[model samples]
Target: MNSLKTNYNIVIVLFVSIFSFQTNAQSAAVDQLHQLYIQTINTGDPGNLNTLYTDNVSIRNSDGSLLTGLNNVKKQYQATFDNGKYDITLKTIEEQDLNEDYMFVSGSFVFTKIDEPEAVQRGTFVNILKNIDGEWKIYKSYRYPEITNIKSIVDGLYKSFAQGDIPSVLEAMDEEIIWNEAEGNAYADGNPYIGPEAVLKGVFERVGAEHEYFKLDDIELHEMSNNQVLATLRYDAKVKETGKTYNAQVAHLWTIRDGKVSAFQQYVDTKKLNDAMSK
Candidate 1:
């Protein structure tokens, strides 16, 4: 059994070494291909863009539009460049080889119209490249726009809370966060919690101490204009003091800025909570 285990380990090491060598050997080609693509964007010239793709390429645009054939893809890119000048940044997320002739590269990108820097767009992309006549070319491409910052940030906070990762939940808030509970709610005595530390002490700590279990239920995030997200949910909890359970309807209005939550206003069915707390 020990000899068998040793052989298995050797096989695994050899497999990894071979894969690493193959990847390293192909890295230069992939980098050159990406640089060529970037050069096309930099020059706003789609004339040479087709050289980066296979003749029968297909593109799945972020807007749900599709273009087939290298010529069609080149035309679409030309049309985009005609609209306005853009500055784009790309980041490679992962790359994997599907045998020797084909591989997939996935990455994220941020692009902005040079004239309107505030209107930045971010998305992720995938390129399936095939080796055609000793040259790597894109066989297929896909782009997906990133979700709005407000909803994404707020969603992450709720996820952290559900996982009992209190530090992460707090870290999402800005240093000067202003938090408020509904006026009639018992927690409102500390209305306008000024910062993360205050929120940790006055709200989260109290909630943990006063409840057997507390959960956010049926959370639906609505993206609002001007960097805010409205979350409709329910507070499901059992009060430790009275041993009574309550599932109160709740809503949270969160204002986010620079990827951190700057303000929070919570609306809850306070009467149900009061009844649960009372003997």
Candidate 2:
């Protein structure tokens, strides 16, 4: 009976050893795959890259466009290489093994134009890898720029404001954001609010104090060049002192950089605002 118990313990120990070995091997393979990808991008060579992805794999680009199939993915990469050479770097933020056959990996990447290293683009990516014939291959992939979606970022800010998420609204602004109100508007007294704190105290707070209910209407975001977004909207507000409502046409030109609003210039019908505030 003691001999049988000893054998059983040995079997358990062997099982644990085998499991640990498998886990370590999987981790090493995944790391190697990422390294290969970086090397391929830097060299502009598709060497063994076809083996990195599944035949039916799909990749989502920063602009929300999808590239389906391995051949198309390869062509896309070649096309990108044709346009310009880039030095790409990837860092894995998180990884999870979903099962024996699948894993999820997410990370951030920086792409620097080889000829112009100063021109760098930062983004995050997600990859779903499937194990086929003991080899892990990307089954699905997604990548998005950190600062490219100017219109979406502005839209999100407005949505946050509508939801009364003041903190989120302020968080979207850059540290040195140059905020300006329409020249003759009351808020212009504190034009060029230097930072988030200044804008919060000088503009947002004052607006909140002077209005019974303030809201934006008819917001149309226009994607402009030079990292700028032009928002054409109407300010719908009721002044607390005069109990009068004003729907003033307004235009906001927002300059964005590094995923933050760097500058804001407001153009509004100042006469409407002045009339609304007059008792």
Tell me model 1's lDDT, rounded to 2 decimals: 0.88
Model 1 bad stretches (over 4 Å) = 1-19, 150-279
Kindly give the stretch of ten consecutive residues in candidate 2 with the minimal lDDT sum: 58-67
All candidates' lDDT scores?
Answer: 0.88, 0.90
Best by TM-score: 2
- Residue 34 C-alpha lDDT in model 1: 78
Tens digits of lDDT, candidate 1, 1-279? 999999999999999999888898677777887788777777788867667989999998865568999788877888889998877778888888897899989998888888888978898999999998877889999987775666888999999999999999998887899999999999999989999999999999999999999999999999998888999999999999999999999999999865678899999999999999989
Error of 1 at 149 (Å): 3.7
Model 2: colliding residue pairs: none
Clashes of each: 0, 0
Cα lDDT for residue 3, model 1?
100
Model 2 residue 10 distance off true place after TM-score fit, in angstroms: 2.1
